[model samples]
Target chain A: MTPFSYTRAGDAADAVRLGAFGGAKYLGGGTNLVDLLRETIERPSALVDVAGLPATIEEREDGSLLIGAATRNAALAEHRAVRSHYPVLARAILAGASAQIRNMATVGGNILQRTRCAYFYDDEGSRCNKRSPGQGCDALDGFNRIHAILGASADCVATHPSDMCVALAALDATVHLQGPAGTRRLKLTGLHRLPGTRPDLETALEPGELITAVELPALPAGARSTYRKVRDRASYAFALVSVAAVLEADSGTVREVRLALGGVAPKPWRARKAEDALRGGPATVQAFRAAAESELADAAPLRDNGFKVELAKRTITAVLGDLAGVAA
Target chain B: MAIRINGTETRAPADPRVSLLDLLRETLHLTGTKKGCNQGACGACTVLADGERILSCLALAVQFEGRSITTIEGLAGQDGMHPLQLAFIEHDGFQCGYCTPGQICSAVGMAAELARGAPSAVTTDLGAATVRFTGEEARERMSGNLCRCGAHNGIIAAITQTYAGAAL
Candidate 1:
């Protein structure tokens, strides 16, 4: 591992100042960044420890949640208000990493976690455009069973490996970021970019910007939500395909629905096309299947991952069916 | 940097890249915390920081400036072996004994979580303040610690026996 200097940030301003020094990144949880440092995938000149920032959950007057960026995953998963109102968020986080990891990783750090793509980690061998810009993507022709099928370009096809971001996408969460310029609010869906030409530019976070909090809008009354992840193992594995959905049906007709998919795209795929198809339609398994198909109709798969199209379709159908009490 | 570990104040000179696991084993010479898959995939480097279990392999030595860390070596008291340690021996909870320290530390932390009414992933209702620990819950919570020796059954038995005895 490359050697780097470490300094603890006294506050958000201190963090930004240290970060603006260039070749510096904020360290929270140190789960992913430390691993990358050991692999020599990320070599920074300095690390500004940002774990001591405001790490609390404040409930708004409208019953929405404003979660601090430094809030640990375990705390967010077990918070009373989150479990009652945003069960999908809690369940999504729990379904992710193991207990030890969740206890250590913060919400901001989890959002900024790197993909687990094997090729991206191969610094010497694999031709990964994300790791090295303008270089060809090895996953395009090499082992790509876990590569992205949507929102991918010729430069890269690496999928974002985050379950929390998928739920946050479906929930319409807003990320509050503080940068050297000033503070800004970015929609969760717009935070992560597609691998179009520059997979290196992954997130919308500006250089030296620090995420302060994530504000969740209130879900509609009587809405039901769930996160279903399909993986090679029941535990301790990345998703083959995961779906996060918020649905409300009245008199057997879909009232409002929001759907987002993971492990299929460079970013958390909000299935707006599918939601449009299911807006006022009858909550039936056939309708769910058609909607899922319509959303995935534009998917372009590589040789080893064409099966992901069918897997994602069925997974979405199953989640929507269970949410609507339709057998599928 | 100075940190408290196992009721002892220890100091490690400035090193940004050395993980807490490396500091304990190499510098502090506490080898009880095993280093299995140093990339945080395996939980053999699990330890308690302020009573919460975290992956020490991924934690940098500098971040834990004044925190209190509890390793497996600190579990036993002057009276001899801890109850959980005795239960593990009685139930034959290990074969290669590589992942024992992590399993034990994680179980200790798991018990504290249950006492504080923290819910696990297997709990159906997240709103419930506390979830009862069944054999399945124990196994699910301990999935981070992998035992290649296939000592899961005995490990579960040991934890269950120790927990039940404590409740009595």
Candidate 2:
């Protein structure tokens, strides 16, 4: 790892000030950042440790939840309110990573974690556009089984590896930010950008911007939600294709739905088209499959990842059908 | 700031790049914690941070200033080996024994998590106030720590026996 100076931020202002310095990165839990440092993929001159900042999960009187960015992933998953109200978020967190990593990883860090593409991590052999812009992408041609099928540019075909963010996207969560320019908010769906010409520019976050908290608006009283991840093996593996959905049905008719997909896009792919198609429609396996097909209509798969399109569609249908009590 | 390890106040390494695993094994000469994959893939360096299990290899020494860390060496008191350690020996829970320290420490932390109702991926009822420690739960919670020796069956038996009746 490169030699660097580490300073624990006293507050949000102090963290922002120290982080704004060139080549400085905010350290949260150090799960991904530490690995990247050892790999020399990230060579920051200094690290602003923000893991000790506000790590609380506040329940608002209006039924909304305000989760501090520094809150440990385990704590968030174990919170009573989160388990009772937003079971999908808790399940999603528990589904990803081991219990040990979850205990160490923070919410903000989970949101900012980089892709798990082998090409991106092969700093020695492979040329990655995300690792070094204007370079080329190896995943586009080489063993691209896990490459993105949606929202991927020709320059990069990597997919985001977060399972929690997929649930947050379906929950319509809002991320609160504090930076040198003051505070602002961005919807979770809008925070991550597609792998356009510049894959290095991943998030909407400006340099030195700190994620303070993530707020989840109240879910409908009758809505039921769940997250389903399909991987090679159970536990401790990233999702090949995952679905997070919140369904509200009234006497076999879909009232409202929020859906998002993971491991198939550059960012958390919100299936807005499927949600639009499912709303007010009869809740059945056929309807679910049609809605899923509609969402994947524009998916352009790579040579090795064409199977993901069908796998994603089936997983989405199964998850929605299970929620709707429809048997295949 | 100094980090408390095994109830001792040990000064942290000055170099910001030293991981907690390296600090334990290299700096303080506490080699009980093993380093498997330097990255977060393998949890051979699993240790207790404030009673919660964490991968020490992924933790920077400077980031854990003033916190309490408990490794495999810290599990047994002056009163002999920890019960989990004894159970591991009885069940022959290890072959090469490279991943034993991590498995024991991780099981210790897992018992605490289950006692507090921290659910795992295999946990069916998220809304339940308490979780039952079954073989399935142990497998899911310990998935981070990989054992190439294929000693998982015996490891699970030892953990199950040692932590019996821990769940509410």
Candidate 3:
């Protein structure tokens, strides 16, 4: 780890003031940043710790949720309102990482966590464009069983390894951020970029911008939502193909639906095409499969991860079918 | 202000790079908290901060200023061993005993989370205020703490025997 000074920010303003300088980074729970530091992947000159900021989860009268960015993953998952209203969010957070990690990870940190691609972490040997720009990506030719299948460019094919973001994308959550230029809001789906030419520049945040809170818009009443993650292990593993869906069906026809996918794209893939196809369509397993296929029609897989296309389609179809009360 | 570890006011490490795991084992000599895979993949560095379980290997000692931390050394009381500790011994929950401290601390935190209605991944009812403490829940909750000796059955047995009958 590079020698760096650490300061606990008194507030969001303090965090931004300290973090805006060159060679400075905002420190959340340090679950991911600390590991990156130890690996010498990120060598910031200074760290402004923002973990002590307001960790509140406020339930609004408008049936929305306002979650502080510093709120731990466990607190978010364990909140009664989140479990009752946004069950998909709760299940998604629980399905990720582990109990210990969930306790230490923060919402903002989870959003900003780097890709778990082996080549990105192999700083000693592997040549990664994300690590060193213009240097070739080894995952393109190396063993890339967990590489991206959608929204990937020739420069980078790394997938975002976040289950919570997938659920947040489905929920239409807005991220409230504060930076040198002041406060602004961005849709969660738009916050993460699709690793076009600069996989190093992951999010849309300006330099030294800090995420303050995430606001979830109210979902339709009686809508069913769930998150399903398929992994090699039963627990404590990253998702191979995950789906987060909130569906509202009446009279065997889809009324409204929000769908997102994880572990198969560079960002939390909001399957808007599938949702558009499913709206007003018969809520049947065949229709669900067709919509999934249509959404994944553009998926381009690498050598070792072609199975992800079929797996992602099946998971999306199964989740939608179950939410629609149809036998998958 | 200093980090309170095991009821002791320990000064933070001068170097900001020093992790809480290193501060405990190297500086304070609290070796009971094992360091398995220092990268948070293995829960061998699990410890309690304000009664919530967190990975100490990834935690910087400087960031824990004025926070109360509890390790395996602080788990046992003056009366001798905690009930879970006794249960582990009785149930033969280890072969090499490397991941025992983390497993014990993680289980303690798991019990508190269960009592507070923190659902695990295996939990069926998300809206339920509390979940039943079953063997399946125990296994899933303790999946972070890996035991290479294949003593998971014994560990689950010990945790179940200790927490299953509780009010949670």
In model 3, state the lDDT of residue A272: 95
Angstrom error of the Cα, residue A230, model 1: value is: 0.8
Candidate 3 per-residue lDDT over residues A1-328, each given as its tens digit:
9999999999999999999999999999999999999999999999999999979999999999999999999999999999999999999999999899999899999999989999999998998999999999999999989999999999899999999999999999999999999999999999999888888888899998999999999999979999999999999999999999999999999999999999999999999999999999999999999999999999999999999999999999999988988999
lDDT of 1: 0.91
RMSD of 3: 0.7
Tens-digit per-residue lDDT, B30-101, candidate 3:
999999999999899999999999999999999999999999999999999999999999999999999999
Residue by residue across A154-211, what tens digits does model 1's lDDT show? Answer: 9998999999999999999999999999999999999998878999999988999999
Ten contiguous residues minimizing lDDT sum, candidate 1 chain A: A231-240
Would candidate 3 be rated incorrect, acceptable, medium or high by CAPRI criteria?
A: high
- The digit string of per-residue lDDT tens for model 1 on B78-135 reads 9999888998899999999999999999989888877766776678777776677788
User: What is the DockQ score of candidate 2, to 2 decimals?
Assistant: 0.94
TM-score per candidate, chains pooled: 0.98, 0.99, 0.99
Instruction: Give one digit per residue, the lDDT tens place, for model 2 in A1-328.
Output: 8889999999899999999999999999999999999999999999999999999999999999999999999999999999999988998999999989999999999999999999999999999999999999999889999889999999999999999999999999999999989999999999999878999999999999999999999999999999999998988999999999999988999999999999999999999999999999999999999999999999999999999999999999999888888896
Q: DockQ, in order, for the candidates?
A: 0.84, 0.94, 0.91
